[model samples]
Target: MPAARPPGGVTVRRLTARDARALTTLPPAMSWIHRTWGGPEALARSGCAWAAFQGDRIVAVACTYFLGTTYEDVACVTVPDPRLQYLALDCVDALCADMAARGHTPSWTCSTSNRPGRLLAWTAGFRPEREYAHYAVGAPAATGRAAAG
Candidate 1:
């Protein structure tokens, strides 16, 4: 299904399954869990994603999910083509509006060195809280002990 455009041809409604295939082509770092777990079918089924399009092409995409109590993590991807910058911001605005309406306070996290993502999140109402370190080890085939052992 095509996105429902706004009166002034600005905002678009929530994403649908039709957008899934296109989004899958985005970089995995951007698509994150949506690419790994919920392919287009799951995106269509869950309806937790949205896109901003120009003409018939999606310029920006965002997939959001609840992390736990009181936290929702949003992953966003842009075409990275300079021509699509405005559309990317539009998607962010639309997504923030939708998240606010749903009573979910949104937060975004990226490695401190991830300059672009940090800048974008800041522009979209996210603020830097504190710096923290993260470590993870892949699970061993034989051990199920949380992958840290």
Candidate 2:
């Protein structure tokens, strides 16, 4: 698929192992990639990462994880620059197209609290598949009981 051409001179391209350092510059919200995928090195090796470049700096990134023979889970993060916000959707679009060509369906799991992410997913033509609650198990509460209880 052809890359997205955002106005204002931004360029989008696939990210590789060489771009690991750039991944580090992403905001904290995107740090989950490091924790879940074993940092930029693993992400680079996944052969499914893409980014938007503004000159020598990385302004946005999108990646996919193959869940099975038929589905790929997509995620993305972008700099807070409003002028460049659209870049995230563009990157995802490119990734989705690439996935389709390879016979894998692209799917997105978005946080309801993340309005921008929801918007981006919708703009990229993703619709709600199903709804499920997400829970995090953290340190014990002061009473030493399960947080849910």
Candidate 3:
């Protein structure tokens, strides 16, 4: 299915390297492309970024990180403006369509504490899958040494 036409004059399209600069202007929270993916050039190189635009202004972004050939981890970020939040759904639709064309299943993890993220994932056709506890080990301690004890 094609992406839905946003209620306003918004449009959705695949993002390119040129879109990188605009992404920097986004609020820090909404600019994960830069923080996590090394900016738009790297994201475009990965070939899995899309954006919702109101004229020339970017309102939302969606990206997928492929896991081997079978699954894709999806993520999205949107402008803080509540009025533009709906654009995220359009981004999700577009990302799903792209994943379908590539023969991959798309999935995302939302923190149990993030009600909004969980709701959006559910609304986008994601079902509850197996839940696993997540564990992280921080960088090595000082003294230029690493110890787990």
Question: TM-score for every candidate vs. truth?
Answer: 0.72, 0.80, 0.81
Q: Model 1 over residues 11-108: C-alpha lDDT tens digits?
A: 44577767666666666666554653456568645666677665555557766654445566777777777645555555666766767777877778
lDDT string for model 3 (12-112, tens) is 89888777777776777666654557776787556687889887778888888544488888888887787776678788878988888899999988788
TM-score order, best first, reads: 3, 2, 1
- Positional deviation of residue 49's Cα in model 1 after best superposition, in angstroms: 1.5
Tens digits of per-residue lDDT, candidate 2, 1-149, equal 22346766688888888888878877778777555678888887677877888986788888885456899888888878867867888889888887898899999887778887788888888998787789979875555465447
- The TM-score of candidate 1 is 0.72
Which stretches of candidate 2 lie above 4 Å from their native place? 1-4, 136-149
| Residue clash pairs of candidate 2 | none
Question: Pick by lDDT: which candidate is best?
Answer: 2
Q: After superposition, how far is residue 142 of candidate 1 from its true place, in Å?
A: 10
Positional deviation of residue 100's Cα in model 3 after best superposition, in angstroms:
1.2
Per-candidate clashes come to 0, 0, 0
